[model samples]
Target chain A: MILNGVEIRDSFAEAFPMVGTRLIITADTAKWAMIAAKTVTGFATSVIGCGCEGGVEREIPESETPDGRPGVSVLFFTMDLKGLQTVVPNRIGQCVLTSPTSACYAGMEGGAKVSIGKALRYFGDGWQIAKNVDGRRIWRVPVMEGEFVCDHDTGSVSGVGGGNILILGASRAETLAAAEVAVEAMQKVEGCILPFPGGIVRSGSKVGSRYKGMFASSNNAYCPTLRAQTETKLTPEVASVQEIVIDGVSFEAVSACTRAGIEALVALGRDKGVVAIDAGNYGGNLGPFHFKLREIMA
Target chain B: MSGFVLTPRRAFETRVDLAGVLPGVDLSGLTVGYGDRGVALAELFEIGGSVGDRLTLKSGSALLDRVGAGLSSGELVVEGDVGDHLGQSAAGGSITVSGSAGAYAAAELSGGRIEIAGDVGERLGAARDGSRRGMSGGVVVVGGSAGPRAAERLRGGVIVVKGDAAEGAATDLIAGTLAVGGALKGKAGRGMKRGTLLLRSADGLAPGFGDALEHDLVMLRVLARRSPDLAAFLGGAFKVRRFAGDLNAGGKGEALVVPAA
Candidate 1:
């Protein structure tokens, strides 16, 4: 089916389960809060290499924060609960604890929990103080500028990761523009984060590589340069493609984010360099969750 | 008014013990001490209303002792002044006294909440002779000042006093937190081993304390946000001058006093 000259593929995006946690980082100003959020989420675009996938969920206003300071909400996803428990503290301890005038807290509530402060409290040596406030244990470790207070543990959620939507267009510039528009729209959805560089992946991967010991490699099938030699999914007119991957607190959140991007692109239609909308799937075999393109657009 | 209301038949000749007699039941078979003689509860106060979650005392006297002691569940309300050992050794549930409480109020309390609208006498929330802890868990909110030796040997829980505390507040605190919104009179924290005494005035601190720099404490802000009712005692402080002390008693305690206006 097509909408305004763009094809709506029958394909679906395959996603799998993940353990995720959300942390709220606050600072005297919004700039530092965002900085800490970016730092902790840095190098965390994929679990295969980075061991986690994390991104800024949103910015919190002063009135809502624990200290009445400006804050940023960030989400991190790992392949398992144990992995999440490891990566979150390392990031917060190194990045946030060192950030001046900043404090971290458990942003999400309920479900299972992982201790972020238990691993970092040793930084205080024998000076750290542990107390309970509103039933959640908090650890306060004195720092040079002041004190670094954080929840002893934050709640972890069973989430969905690897949800994707591919923006295929006739030229490189148009394809990038289309992906940009989709990213802008998808960011509005709650409980989801785009964990890629600029929320778009240029070198999208298939399942595995021909080289020994490599688990994943580039998607040659969707590459414009390999259109002639490989089993290319791209049409002769299609010149470039961009992948927008999503990781969220729930399957429904990923689906909503995907639908938001599709809605935004479909509204812009052919005028924004006409092409088609497709999704990534491993023949619907690997992951348990599937987001069908046509069904979603319908 | 809906729950059990026990009003005295007349002024007590001697202090009476009213422990373990809870609500949600009839007091017909329940026998309690009236002075040295055992008397039926009906022989004392005029019983009114059916059994319910709350047990309200229409009036109180210095003769009423061990009020709501060993209360495991349900609410107990006292409308007037009560004698010593008010809510003593209660494990759970909530006890609220609308009037002043005598000495040993909530002494050896392990769990549950106690709220007093007026002054509490000396040795408030203090442990008895042999026990290692007093007011071990739960919260106590005193709307008015406290007498000397408040929170003695307190191993756990929180106590917030809205007005000045007399001498010896937190004298032998073991652990947990006690925050006083008003000035602390005379020397305090004499034998504090491990705990925090958050107060507004530091003028009365003992020589056992040594000045630690005025520093920002995020825990105060966090506590203020978590429990707003106790925020007044924390002085809504972003920074406080810490006195690391009771050094004569092993030094793990602190008296965090908010800067003077």
Candidate 2:
């Protein structure tokens, strides 16, 4: 299927089931909230190396937050439930609690409930006071700037990760620009995230590895230098490839984001050497819902 | 009986547990469903009340725990006395008791108003067991004296006791206001962080509180006008002796002792 002269790859984007949590981190201002959120979501591009994948979901106004502060909602995902429990509190305590004038709250209401504040209350050193308002428990810890209120527990649920599309461009600059636009467009869609560094990944990986110690290795199929040596599928004009990975709360959310990112990239076509939009799939055997690039674009 | 009236059919001496009776149970149309000795609400109180403007529970000594727990809207009036927790977490409504009430009346109340014409037992407006915060919002007015530990660890809300308050009143209050018309001999405003506690008595002040300043705060007028029973203590205007601390407790709360000049 050709969408706006860009060839839609017939392959589907493979994904895996993972447990996820949404957190609302608030600060005195929107800028600080973004800083905390970005820090918490940093190094969390994939469960392969970082053990979690997280991204800024949205920005919330002060009136919308529980503590009346400007906040940002972030989605964090892990390969399993136990992995989620390990990654969430560590990141929140290190990134959010250490931030100035910041408070953390649970975005998900009732799911696989785990207590973050109940565990982190030890940081207050006998000064943390628990407040239960309207049945929701919040812990107020004495901080240098008066108090910091955080929800006792947050909810976690199963989500999908590794829903991705690759932009193959003739030059590195063209590939980076198209990837940036795709990231911006995908970020606007709710419940989905581009978890890579600056929402673009140049070193996309495959399922298996050549070394005995490694479980997975890089995707050599899209490597520009190996185009002539290997069973290359890239066209003659394609020189560089940039990948965008998405983690979403559901299959529909990921599909919607994929469609949006592809549409945005296609709109800014081939000025520098943009050739086609292709997807990475594990032979349609990994995930439950197979999102074919051609079918999704059509 | 303009509104709903709940009248017990027969007098009950033994405690008839009513903990889960009024949970999401509407009291629009007032009437007794069923009643007997040592029986629960299902056996005694008939469910016939329609959603209305007000609900009146005709007085008796039979009711036990949780009479009106989690009531969201409308009005509830007890013609006589009530059991414990008369209006626990009542979101939006007014509950008036003509006689005394048992322990934990209006515990953890969020919004609305509760007025008891008679005395109240211990732990009125205190937090439930194992819960941290207590009575985040609402206004509670007690006409007679109140028992010990009244408004303990209250986060936010207003509580006014017209008669003398028992020991440990307004202990560990985080926010909101508490006004007592009669004398308070016990440790008042102990470990308060940020709140206003007004004592309209000549019995002097608690040792835990230190004198802050002497001024006539006009906010008392606004608070008094909200409840007529509380308004009587203002008496047009009076000198408010302000005291700060529970210095023992970070020295944040202000205790105003109103002296008659």
Candidate 3:
């Protein structure tokens, strides 16, 4: 099936179950909030490398924030509950606590709660104080600027990760541009994140590797360099490819954002050098939900 | 008007321990249904007025200890002075005392409103002597002066004292607002963070609060409107001296002293 003259790949995007927590970090101004958020989400591109995947979910207005300050909501994902417990406090302590005039709170209130502030309160030594207002517990830790008011615990829930799409183009620059556009679109969608660097993955992986110890290898089927020697599926016009990976609280959220992103990038295919938009999958066997590219685009 | 009212049948010389009587008792379920001593509530207090949405105790001086402990909802009004632990762990509801009350007036109250028109003993809105969490949430308004440690380890909630407050008011307060209209004799907001302690006079600002700033805050205007009792001290147009420290605890909290006009 073709969407806007670009072929819709029949293959589905695979995803895995994970745990996620949302943190609302606020500061004196939006700049500091963004700075702290960026740091907290830094190096958190994938669980394979960073043990977590996190990104800025949205910019919250002061009225919606806990402390009536400009803040940003961030979504952090980990492969397991224990990983989440470790990654949340460490990142918040190192990044948010170190930022000036910043306060961190749990965006999710109900469900199973994890104590990020309860653990980080040690940074305040014996000076930490607990405050409970309107049924919400917050910790007041003394910082250089004043006090950092953070929620004692943050709530965590099961989420989905590893949803991905590959953008094929005639040139490396064209593929990168298409991927950037897709990332920009996905960033606007709620409850979903493109955790890769600049939201683009250059080295797409396959199920297994030929190396004795490696669990996965590169996706040689779509490699422009190996097209002459391997069983290549890429058209002769396709010279470069980039992938966009999404992590979301639910399969529907990830699929919806992925669809929007793929459609937006596919619309750019009418231009020169743009080839097609496809998704990466492990033969529809690894994940629970199979998001068919044609069905999603249609 | 909607609560439980216990009017004593006869004046007794012996002090009656009313502790553990009001636990899990809501306004509708409370009744002086008549029994002997330690039997039903009717035997202790005369069954006169109809049980409404609130429980009102009239002309009782023999009552002592845990008068309104662990009350979840509704109102409990005591016409006479009550003993210790007036409204302990009162999750939700209002408990008003026309007369004075003993120590731990509203200790560890999670939610609700407690008002004492008369004076209260020490530890007015504090934790249960040794607990970490004090009045977690709710509002406790004292028309008269409060004893020492008015809001110790208070996690969240507002404690407003219309009259002068004693020493060690708001010590180790984690978060919440404490407003004192009269002069504070002792340390205020010691080791406090992420909470606001507003005092009418400069006496309440401890040595920990460093710099002072003079400015008009719009939020103060809103706060005054919500609490008219606070309006007497924070009312009209006034310049506020802001102290930023408790620097010992990272100095994050603010102590706003209403400058004399």
Candidate number achieving the greatest lDDT relative to the actual structure: 1
Q: Considering every candidate listed, which one attains the maximal DockQ?
A: 1
How far off is residue A18 in model 2, in Å? Answer: 0.5
The candidate that wins on TM-score is: 1
lDDT of 3 by residue, A1-298 (tens): 7666666777888888999989989887999999999999999987877889999988999777765579899999998999998889999989999998788888886667777778988988877756544555567676666567688898988999989888888799878888888888888888887877887889988877888877668899989999888998798888998998899988889989988887787778647455787888887777886777878876
Name the fnat for model 1. Answer: 0.54
**For model 1, what TM-score does chain A reach?**
0.98
| Ranking of predictions according to lDDT | 1, 3, 2
Off by over 4 Å in 1: B259-261
TM-scores of all models?
0.94, 0.70, 0.74
RMSD (CA, Å), each prediction: 2.1, 8.7, 6.2
Q: TM-score of each model's B chain?
A: 0.93, 0.84, 0.84
Location of the lowest summed lDDT over 10 successive residues in candidate 1 chain B? B229-238
User: Compared to the true structure, candidate 3 yields what TM-score?
Assistant: 0.74
- Using TM-score as the measure, name the better of candidate 2 and candidate 3: 3
- Name the candidate, 1 or 2, with the larger TM-score value: 1
Interface RMSD of each: 1.8, 10.4, 6.9
